[model samples]
Target: MNLPLNRRLFMVGAAAIAVSGPAFANTTHIVEMLNRHPDNKKLRNVFSPSVLKVQPGDTITFMPTDKGHNSVSIDGMMPKGASGWKGKNSKEVSVTLDLPGIYGYKCQPHYGLGMVGVIIVEGEGMGGNLDAAKDVKQRGKAKAAFVDHWDQIKAQGLLTPPAEQ
Candidate 1:
Protein backbone atom coordinates (compact mmCIF):
# COMPACT_ATOMS: atom_id res chain seq x y z
CA MET A 1 0.00 0.00 0.00
CA ASN A 2 1.31 3.44 -0.90
CA LEU A 3 0.80 6.24 1.60
CA PRO A 4 1.55 9.95 1.82
CA LEU A 5 4.85 10.86 3.58
CA ASN A 6 3.14 12.36 6.68
CA ARG A 7 0.81 9.37 7.09
CA ARG A 8 3.74 6.95 6.66
CA LEU A 9 5.74 8.76 9.33
CA PHE A 10 2.74 8.74 11.67
CA MET A 11 2.23 5.01 11.15
CA VAL A 12 5.93 4.34 11.86
CA GLY A 13 5.85 6.41 15.03
CA ALA A 14 2.75 4.62 16.26
CA ALA A 15 4.31 1.25 15.56
CA ALA A 16 7.45 2.22 17.45
CA ILE A 17 5.44 3.35 20.46
CA ALA A 18 3.48 0.13 20.40
CA VAL A 19 6.65 -1.95 20.33
CA SER A 20 8.18 -0.18 23.31
CA GLY A 21 7.66 -2.05 26.58
CA PRO A 22 7.86 -1.35 30.27
CA ALA A 23 10.92 0.43 31.61
CA PHE A 24 11.81 -2.47 33.89
CA ALA A 25 10.45 -5.78 35.02
CA ASN A 26 9.91 -6.61 38.66
CA THR A 27 12.01 -9.40 40.17
CA THR A 28 11.51 -12.11 42.78
CA HIS A 29 14.36 -12.83 45.23
CA ILE A 30 14.73 -15.97 47.32
CA VAL A 31 16.11 -16.24 50.83
CA GLU A 32 16.51 -19.53 52.64
CA MET A 33 16.14 -20.37 56.32
CA LEU A 34 18.84 -22.68 57.54
CA ASN A 35 19.59 -24.45 60.78
CA ARG A 36 23.30 -24.03 60.09
CA HIS A 37 25.07 -21.92 57.54
CA PRO A 38 25.51 -23.95 54.36
CA ASP A 39 29.18 -23.12 53.91
CA ASN A 40 30.19 -22.54 57.52
CA LYS A 41 29.09 -25.03 60.12
CA LYS A 42 30.23 -22.81 62.97
CA LEU A 43 27.49 -20.33 62.05
CA ARG A 44 24.27 -21.87 63.32
CA ASN A 45 20.72 -20.68 62.70
CA VAL A 46 21.02 -18.31 59.76
CA PHE A 47 19.61 -17.13 56.49
CA SER A 48 21.64 -17.86 53.41
CA PRO A 49 22.53 -14.64 51.54
CA SER A 50 21.69 -12.67 54.67
CA VAL A 51 21.70 -9.35 52.83
CA LEU A 52 19.72 -8.90 49.62
CA LYS A 53 19.41 -5.85 47.42
CA VAL A 54 16.35 -5.41 45.23
CA GLN A 55 14.60 -2.79 43.19
CA PRO A 56 11.23 -1.32 43.90
CA GLY A 57 8.23 -3.56 43.11
CA ASP A 58 10.36 -6.64 43.64
CA THR A 59 9.04 -9.65 45.55
CA ILE A 60 10.96 -11.34 48.33
CA THR A 61 10.31 -14.98 49.16
CA PHE A 62 11.47 -16.50 52.40
CA MET A 63 12.01 -20.19 51.84
CA PRO A 64 11.99 -22.62 54.73
CA THR A 65 14.91 -24.98 54.25
CA ASP A 66 14.61 -26.11 57.83
CA LYS A 67 11.78 -26.68 60.27
CA GLY A 68 10.66 -24.48 63.18
CA HIS A 69 11.40 -21.17 61.51
CA ASN A 70 9.28 -18.35 60.13
CA SER A 71 9.99 -14.96 58.52
CA VAL A 72 8.69 -11.94 60.36
CA SER A 73 9.37 -8.30 59.60
CA ILE A 74 11.04 -6.50 62.44
CA ASP A 75 9.13 -3.68 64.10
CA GLY A 76 10.28 -0.18 63.11
CA MET A 77 12.39 -1.58 60.33
CA MET A 78 10.29 -1.01 57.22
CA PRO A 79 9.61 2.24 55.43
CA LYS A 80 6.67 4.37 56.43
CA GLY A 81 3.46 3.22 54.70
CA ALA A 82 4.99 -0.22 54.26
CA SER A 83 3.20 -2.93 56.22
CA GLY A 84 4.91 -5.76 58.07
CA TRP A 85 4.39 -9.48 57.44
CA LYS A 86 4.72 -12.66 59.46
CA GLY A 87 4.81 -16.18 58.12
CA LYS A 88 3.61 -19.24 60.02
CA ASN A 89 6.28 -21.50 61.42
CA SER A 90 7.97 -23.57 58.76
CA LYS A 91 5.96 -21.93 56.03
CA GLU A 92 7.13 -19.98 53.02
CA VAL A 93 6.02 -16.40 52.61
CA SER A 94 6.41 -14.01 49.71
CA VAL A 95 6.06 -10.27 50.04
CA THR A 96 6.06 -7.64 47.27
CA LEU A 97 7.85 -4.56 48.51
CA ASP A 98 6.79 -1.45 46.63
CA LEU A 99 8.18 1.11 49.01
CA PRO A 100 11.87 1.84 48.67
CA GLY A 101 13.83 1.46 51.91
CA ILE A 102 15.46 -1.07 54.19
CA TYR A 103 13.48 -4.06 55.47
CA GLY A 104 14.70 -6.18 58.35
CA TYR A 105 13.33 -9.66 58.90
CA LYS A 106 14.11 -12.59 61.13
CA CYS A 107 13.60 -16.30 61.64
CA GLN A 108 11.37 -16.09 64.68
CA PRO A 109 12.45 -19.25 66.50
CA HIS A 110 16.13 -18.36 66.25
CA TYR A 111 15.86 -14.58 66.43
CA GLY A 112 17.70 -14.49 69.68
CA LEU A 113 20.49 -16.52 68.11
CA GLY A 114 20.54 -13.97 65.25
CA MET A 115 18.87 -15.52 62.25
CA VAL A 116 18.25 -12.15 60.67
CA GLY A 117 18.13 -10.91 57.09
CA VAL A 118 18.14 -7.59 55.29
CA ILE A 119 16.32 -6.59 52.12
CA ILE A 120 17.29 -3.24 50.64
CA VAL A 121 14.93 -1.75 48.11
CA GLU A 122 16.96 0.62 45.97
CA GLY A 123 15.57 3.83 44.46
CA GLU A 124 14.09 7.03 45.75
CA GLY A 125 13.64 7.26 49.53
CA MET A 126 15.60 4.08 50.19
CA GLY A 127 17.71 5.44 53.00
CA GLY A 128 14.86 7.31 54.62
CA ASN A 129 14.29 4.63 57.25
CA LEU A 130 17.88 3.50 57.52
CA ASP A 131 19.02 5.35 60.60
CA ALA A 132 15.72 4.67 62.35
CA ALA A 133 15.97 0.96 61.63
CA LYS A 134 19.55 0.94 62.86
CA ASP A 135 18.53 2.68 66.06
CA VAL A 136 15.89 0.11 66.89
CA LYS A 137 17.37 -2.01 69.68
CA GLN A 138 18.40 -5.60 69.05
CA ARG A 139 19.09 -8.44 71.49
CA GLY A 140 21.42 -11.44 71.68
CA LYS A 141 23.58 -12.08 68.63
CA ALA A 142 21.14 -10.11 66.50
CA LYS A 143 22.85 -6.89 67.52
CA ALA A 144 26.23 -7.99 66.26
CA ALA A 145 24.70 -9.64 63.23
CA PHE A 146 22.91 -6.49 62.11
CA VAL A 147 25.99 -4.41 62.81
CA ASP A 148 27.96 -6.63 60.45
CA HIS A 149 25.23 -6.43 57.84
CA TRP A 150 25.29 -2.64 57.94
CA ASP A 151 29.04 -2.65 57.69
CA GLN A 152 28.87 -4.99 54.74
CA ILE A 153 26.36 -2.77 53.05
CA LYS A 154 28.58 0.24 53.41
CA ALA A 155 31.75 -1.56 52.46
CA GLN A 156 30.16 -3.11 49.40
CA GLY A 157 28.82 0.26 48.25
CA LEU A 158 25.26 -0.99 48.24
CA LEU A 159 23.89 1.79 50.36
CA THR A 160 23.14 4.19 47.50
CA PRO A 161 22.18 3.00 44.09
CA PRO A 162 23.45 4.42 40.82
CA ALA A 163 21.51 7.41 39.64
CA GLU A 164 19.55 7.16 36.43
CA GLN A 165 20.99 8.90 33.42
Candidate 2:
Protein backbone atom coordinates (compact mmCIF):
# COMPACT_ATOMS: atom_id res chain seq x y z
CA MET A 1 0.00 0.00 0.00
CA ASN A 2 1.38 3.42 -0.93
CA LEU A 3 0.92 5.94 1.92
CA PRO A 4 1.23 9.72 1.72
CA LEU A 5 4.68 11.11 2.54
CA ASN A 6 3.31 13.33 5.35
CA ARG A 7 1.55 10.41 7.06
CA ARG A 8 4.69 8.25 6.89
CA LEU A 9 6.79 11.02 8.43
CA PHE A 10 4.30 11.56 11.19
CA MET A 11 4.23 7.89 12.08
CA VAL A 12 8.02 7.73 12.15
CA GLY A 13 8.22 10.76 14.45
CA ALA A 14 5.66 9.25 16.84
CA ALA A 15 7.58 6.00 17.01
CA ALA A 16 10.80 7.81 17.80
CA ILE A 17 9.21 9.78 20.60
CA ALA A 18 7.81 6.64 22.16
CA VAL A 19 11.17 4.94 22.06
CA SER A 20 13.02 7.87 23.68
CA GLY A 21 10.42 8.80 26.29
CA PRO A 22 10.76 8.48 30.04
CA ALA A 23 11.77 4.97 31.09
CA PHE A 24 9.11 3.02 32.91
CA ALA A 25 11.25 -0.04 33.51
CA ASN A 26 13.28 0.20 36.69
CA THR A 27 16.87 -0.96 37.17
CA THR A 28 17.64 -2.88 40.33
CA HIS A 29 20.94 -2.77 42.28
CA ILE A 30 21.87 -5.43 44.80
CA VAL A 31 23.63 -4.57 48.05
CA GLU A 32 24.91 -7.25 50.38
CA MET A 33 25.05 -6.92 54.16
CA LEU A 34 28.29 -8.18 55.65
CA ASN A 35 29.25 -8.67 59.28
CA ARG A 36 32.72 -8.40 60.78
CA HIS A 37 34.21 -7.35 57.44
CA PRO A 38 37.73 -7.56 58.98
CA ASP A 39 38.67 -4.30 57.28
CA ASN A 40 38.33 -2.38 60.54
CA LYS A 41 35.68 0.25 59.92
CA LYS A 42 32.76 1.60 61.85
CA LEU A 43 29.70 -0.58 62.20
CA ARG A 44 31.03 -4.11 61.77
CA ASN A 45 27.97 -5.22 59.84
CA VAL A 46 28.35 -3.41 56.52
CA PHE A 47 26.79 -2.83 53.15
CA SER A 48 29.10 -3.87 50.35
CA PRO A 49 29.68 -1.36 47.53
CA SER A 50 28.77 1.22 50.10
CA VAL A 51 28.33 3.91 47.49
CA LEU A 52 26.25 3.44 44.34
CA LYS A 53 25.36 5.73 41.43
CA VAL A 54 22.05 5.28 39.65
CA GLN A 55 19.54 7.09 37.48
CA PRO A 56 16.12 8.24 38.54
CA GLY A 57 13.47 5.50 38.66
CA ASP A 58 15.99 2.82 39.65
CA THR A 59 15.59 0.47 42.58
CA ILE A 60 18.01 -0.80 45.19
CA THR A 61 17.59 -4.10 47.00
CA PHE A 62 19.30 -4.57 50.33
CA MET A 63 19.80 -8.24 51.15
CA PRO A 64 20.75 -9.27 54.62
CA THR A 65 23.65 -11.64 54.10
CA ASP A 66 23.83 -11.79 57.87
CA LYS A 67 21.02 -11.70 60.39
CA GLY A 68 19.82 -8.64 62.35
CA HIS A 69 20.27 -5.77 59.92
CA ASN A 70 18.00 -3.38 58.05
CA SER A 71 18.32 -0.37 55.70
CA VAL A 72 16.95 3.04 56.71
CA SER A 73 17.37 6.53 55.31
CA ILE A 74 19.28 9.16 57.23
CA ASP A 75 17.37 12.03 58.83
CA GLY A 76 18.54 14.86 56.60
CA MET A 77 20.30 13.34 53.64
CA MET A 78 17.41 12.88 51.21
CA PRO A 79 16.30 15.35 48.55
CA LYS A 80 13.92 18.16 49.35
CA GLY A 81 10.80 16.32 48.17
CA ALA A 82 11.88 12.79 48.99
CA SER A 83 10.57 10.81 51.93
CA GLY A 84 12.45 8.58 54.33
CA TRP A 85 12.17 4.78 54.35
CA LYS A 86 13.29 1.84 56.41
CA GLY A 87 13.35 -1.93 56.03
CA LYS A 88 12.55 -4.45 58.68
CA ASN A 89 15.52 -5.97 60.43
CA SER A 90 16.87 -9.15 58.77
CA LYS A 91 14.39 -8.77 55.90
CA GLU A 92 15.18 -7.97 52.31
CA VAL A 93 13.85 -4.63 51.08
CA SER A 94 13.80 -2.96 47.70
CA VAL A 95 13.51 0.83 47.40
CA THR A 96 12.50 2.65 44.24
CA LEU A 97 14.23 5.96 43.71
CA ASP A 98 12.00 8.63 42.18
CA LEU A 99 13.87 11.79 43.10
CA PRO A 100 17.28 13.00 41.95
CA GLY A 101 19.78 13.59 44.75
CA ILE A 102 22.11 11.90 47.20
CA TYR A 103 20.50 9.42 49.57
CA GLY A 104 22.39 8.43 52.67
CA TYR A 105 21.20 5.40 54.57
CA LYS A 106 22.32 3.15 57.37
CA CYS A 107 21.57 -0.07 59.19
CA GLN A 108 19.63 0.78 62.30
CA PRO A 109 21.19 -1.91 64.42
CA HIS A 110 24.75 -0.83 63.71
CA TYR A 111 24.45 2.90 63.04
CA GLY A 112 26.99 3.74 65.70
CA LEU A 113 29.55 1.43 64.23
CA GLY A 114 28.87 3.15 60.84
CA MET A 115 26.97 0.60 58.79
CA VAL A 116 26.00 3.13 56.15
CA GLY A 117 25.57 3.50 52.40
CA VAL A 118 25.05 6.20 49.77
CA ILE A 119 23.04 6.36 46.56
CA ILE A 120 23.59 9.11 43.99
CA VAL A 121 20.84 9.65 41.44
CA GLU A 122 21.48 11.59 38.25
CA GLY A 123 18.56 12.92 36.25
CA GLU A 124 17.89 15.59 33.63
CA GLY A 125 19.10 18.85 35.16
CA MET A 126 18.63 17.31 38.56
CA GLY A 127 19.88 19.68 41.24
CA GLY A 128 20.65 17.53 44.24
CA ASN A 129 20.31 18.59 47.89
CA LEU A 130 23.99 18.62 48.64
CA ASP A 131 23.75 20.87 51.66
CA ALA A 132 21.09 18.75 53.31
CA ALA A 133 23.00 15.59 52.55
CA LYS A 134 26.07 17.04 54.16
CA ASP A 135 24.12 17.95 57.27
CA VAL A 136 23.15 14.43 58.21
CA LYS A 137 23.99 14.23 61.86
CA GLN A 138 25.52 10.88 62.74
CA ARG A 139 27.28 9.69 65.86
CA GLY A 140 30.72 8.23 66.38
CA LYS A 141 31.90 5.94 63.62
CA ALA A 142 28.82 6.64 61.55
CA LYS A 143 29.85 10.29 61.20
CA ALA A 144 33.33 9.32 60.10
CA ALA A 145 32.01 6.79 57.64
CA PHE A 146 29.68 9.31 56.01
CA VAL A 147 32.55 11.81 55.72
CA ASP A 148 34.70 9.25 53.92
CA HIS A 149 32.00 8.38 51.42
CA TRP A 150 31.10 12.04 50.81
CA ASP A 151 34.75 12.77 50.10
CA GLN A 152 34.94 9.99 47.58
CA ILE A 153 31.90 11.30 45.77
CA LYS A 154 33.44 14.75 45.53
CA ALA A 155 36.87 13.44 44.50
CA GLN A 156 35.39 11.18 41.85
CA GLY A 157 33.19 13.99 40.46
CA LEU A 158 30.24 11.66 40.47
CA LEU A 159 27.93 14.57 41.22
CA THR A 160 28.52 18.29 41.22
CA PRO A 161 27.63 20.52 44.13
CA PRO A 162 24.22 22.09 43.69
CA ALA A 163 25.60 25.57 44.26
CA GLU A 164 28.18 25.11 41.55
CA GLN A 165 25.78 23.55 39.07
**Listing every candidate in turn, what is its Cα RMSD in Å to the true structure after a full C-alpha superposition?**
3.2, 4.2
**Residue 165 in model 1: shift from native, Å?**
2.7
Q: What is residue 32's positional error in candidate 1, in angstroms?
A: 0.6
* Per-residue error (Å), model 1, residue 90: 0.7
Per-residue lDDT of candidate 1, residues 49-164 (tens digit): 89999988989888888888899999999999999999999999999998889999888889899889899998877888999999999999999999999999888888776867
| lDDT per model vs. reference | 0.90, 0.83
Model 2 lDDT at residue 121? 85
Candidate 2, which segments miss by more than 4 Å at Cα? 1-25, 36-43, 124-127, 161-165
TM-score of each: 0.86, 0.77
